[model samples]
Target: MDKRESKIPLIRFPEFKEGWEHKQLNELLKVSKKKNKDLKYSKEEVLSVSGELGIVNQIEHLGRSYAGASVHNYGLVENGDIVYTKSPLKENPYGIIKLNKGVPGIVSTLYAVYKVKDNNADGEFIEHYFSLDANTNRYLRPLVRKGAKNDMKINNEYVLHDRIFVPKKEEQKRIAHFFNVIDTKINQLKEKQNLLEEYKKGVMQKIFTQKIRFKKEDGSDFENWDNTTLGKVFKIFNGYAFSSKDSCENGVKWVKIADVGIQRMQRENVSFLPFEFRELHKKFLLKKGDFVIALTRPILNGELKIAEIDDFFHNSLLNQRVGKIISSNNLIFIYYFLQQQWLINSIEKNIAGTDPPNLSAKEIDHIKVSIPKVKEQEKIAKILSNIDNKIAKSINQIDNLKNYKKALLQQMFCY
Candidate 1:
């Protein structure tokens, strides 16, 4: 490590030129051990601290507050209180440090709550630095000891004894303020993306249910729809079964049921077929705009993963238990229709009751669907696609913003 006296960050605000000094956590905050004596106290103020999200309302985290009525000896916490959970969370098998603000609440004894004692230290700034540093858990890991439960954890003593580097109050304010602004924009982008997705869902419902109708060349409403089986409209081709022995480092990339998502193939967990076998299964090769579905465990995620293939999707080989939906009619319409909520629920319930966990291609093809005129189908698909494109663009922007914030975090803090 560089000399503590010369502890400069990779990037600085230029206004302040002094090197940052390292300080143990005990110098800044100490564990707050105040407890609730009144079991029936209305100051239940239950809250939870998530690894990434920090402090949040308990109801929001657990659907309902786990601390119902009569929560005794619960730790009392106020706004600006810092909570350190020494146990492992879901994705974070280590621990998380957080600052609770505005959402004044109570947490369980399981959490070691601390309060800032030093006037110069900023709780939010400290929390942000620890969060940005990936080794935060490791730094605190030594504090952890085996508890009655299987999980190991640090106690209040260790939590209060730890230390970290903190800048002067003004500098801390500048850094915290910068991240806050970026966070606000990120939240706004996410909200816009979510609203657009919800709007598209409503639009899909309207079009599929005939609440909204498309017109003909003369501007007249299209004729009544015809009820037909999916098999009648489209040819469902199940993917080829390539053995594990045929799997290779490089060759045709094969998509499995696990790779399929309603929006698109994730393509991350995809396996590849041996180059030798690629020549024999040319017809099995998939191309752009090919609509596909997961056949086995079709309803595993509550809804099926239906997606249109990307033109440049690598190799694009289809594996068994996955299938491509083919139609001479408008392909986009079929893709959207399959995603209709009520239709999917009905299919899932049917499959859940009698069918094995696995659904066969024949069962899927037998499902009934409403077929509108080709022109009307084309119009509906176009409208939905436009909304989907907007949502996709917003998501891409949010991702870029998150990446930029990550880069800033890496540069703005010292080791």
Candidate 2:
């Protein structure tokens, strides 16, 4: 531990000027070894501790019961109780601690349950101390021990005796509350994003089914839609067969079928071709407003990921198993139409039942559709696009807030 950490954290409240005192975990918190008393009948929420989500009710989260035959022998935990799952995780080798709140519940027997012994020793403060980058990547990592089954576990004695520097009770509460406020804001934004997405989905269904028809400019009914083959409106094109040797770090972007999904194009997993060979990939390069889909996955419920490429994804070369649809019709309208269940089912029926189902470019070209007139298509696009914009903005805001909190966790704690 750095000498400076013993005296103060990288950031702190202005009023707390004294150095924090170090104490062993056992001295600060008491182990809760009491077993569940409801042996006759278990009725409370069945809890489990996940290193990622912390402690949560298993049945509610999984949409079904994952609770063993019964949790009669499980450990009991109450509000403000701190629980630790002592199993190793790939990212967090020393296990993880979660402070349970809101209700009293029962966790599996295979966890360490404890209570704050010192009235001044806040559970939230301890949770933050353990979670901070300065402690996770630096202090706790080194203390993990190799145990039976080759799993990493911190020695019970070592963990119990491990010392941590803590601020006064009031200061600790303030710091914990600061993070809580941020968490509440993030959750609110997430709920807003979810509602917007659901609203857009419902609207799409209504418009496609003609339940909500678009009117002509003069407030008159538009002409009936005409049935037409997709080939007339779209020029279907399959991606190039790029070899492994063509991969490069700093080169032209090569978008594979897997790189594109319903959530939009994934930027991090994209591969590239040598910049010098950009000329060779010119014919395969994608442009803004191109409709693309993963042909290899065929079409399965929720497996169909199709989207219209925006300027952000322009100039990208399409790789094998991906197909792009170029058309004069509004690309945005075609993008959403492809996502409708009927179109997805039509595309799936063409697959030949190969190990991994695949779609042929010809099949995509020949599929028939009843399209709206150009004006109606544009109107539908605007409604859907507006909701998309709202969802996108909320998602971006949530991501930014998470990053901001992560930065604070790293900088505010002692090293």
Candidate 3:
């Protein structure tokens, strides 16, 4: 192994005998707050932002729901610029900025951009260091204020005044290179995962719509698919309204729609309800294999369609606006089927809502579904389940790697 030393030996290379130089951010950088810039852009050139991945240029506002506004004010950003939102106080408030292809607009007023000092460091290298998980959380977390109306509000002064370790230029580049290699692998896997999901969604659409049919081993089509209402095939029930007044540390497990994470049901995030209330709402208790669907959401255009009730979440009861699928026609099959895009489109077409879109039991009952033989359904589920199993395993590995990298950074870098 190549030996390295510094205040922390692991942070610097062995060949590098120079001690780290501490410096104020402004002294080593040209800091430009987007809000303070005097730049302007036409509506056509206006850029949209989300967190730190600067200036989306597709002009395709294809989101799960509504798209956000465009930034048209004074904000200078180019390739390699580090951009971060400065208004909303958030748990982790910063990200390394990037200007995507086809993007031609200036930075949004929400960002604070930093151009590295030519005498001191490489801009890309600094951006990479700042993008490190530990640095982002360590530097930005404390800048957040609790009572701020916006979730994040970081000013230029706070960031500029914070003291940071400035390694020699060569070391900075080397460290950035190491992390960038790992990051590329992680990003590549993530893209594969996304593509696999899209493929599965497409397959689901074909199967449910009868565009593609599952054939029996005998080379014959499983009898003409029957049409059935979801209500008949599954038991749909509303969740219990656990009283906020009696909420305490030790109580029965309760879940809200918000408790459901993007891809999995967050059993660990569950809150406890009073025992009396739990007993009263016992009928609505969750069981493994049960599906929980978010019934109330303004963006009900089919996002967050389903969640399986895992064993860890057993005895948990759903809360108001969340729909529990107590029983179903082979849940494993239903789970994969609901994840299909075509099914989501169908649900969206039939969904009824006011200000906050809500899917009712009646509307759910009217949802048309292809009824395949239970055995065939199980078979199809198995095929898709294997693919998903691989995807989940890959994600777990990535999480472990990220955690390991975080731990390594903490040990190697000075906090």
**Per-residue C-alpha lDDT of model 3 across residues 224-320, encoded as one tens digit per residue:** 8667766666766888766777677887777787766544776555678777776787787887767788777613444654777777777777788
Deviation in Å, model 2, residue 210 alpha carbon: 1.5
Using lDDT, rank the candidates from best to worst.
1, 2, 3
Better of 1 and 3 by TM-score: 1
Better of 2 and 3 by TM-score: 2
Reference-based lDDT, residue 64, model 1? 77
Alpha-carbon RMSD to native, per candidate? 3.0, 3.3, 5.3
262-314 per-residue lDDT for model 2 (tens digits): 74876767777887656876888888877788778845454477876777678
Where model 1 places Cα greater than 4 Å from the true spot, the runs are: 1-6, 40-45, 65-70, 89-91, 133-135, 145-150, 354-356
lDDT of each: 0.77, 0.75, 0.63
The pairs that clash in candidate 3 are 4-14, 87-152, 88-151, 88-152, 88-153, 89-151, 89-152, 89-153, 90-151, 90-152
TM-score of predicted structure 1: 0.89
Better of 2 and 3 by lDDT: 2
Give the CA lDDT, 0 to 100, for residue 272 in model 3: 80
- Candidate 2 residue spans exceeding 4 A from truth: 1-5, 40-44, 50-53, 86-94, 131-134, 137-139, 146-150, 154-158, 228-236, 298-303, 310-312, 341-353, 361-369
Considering every candidate listed, which one attains the maximal lDDT? 1
Best candidate according to TM-score = 1
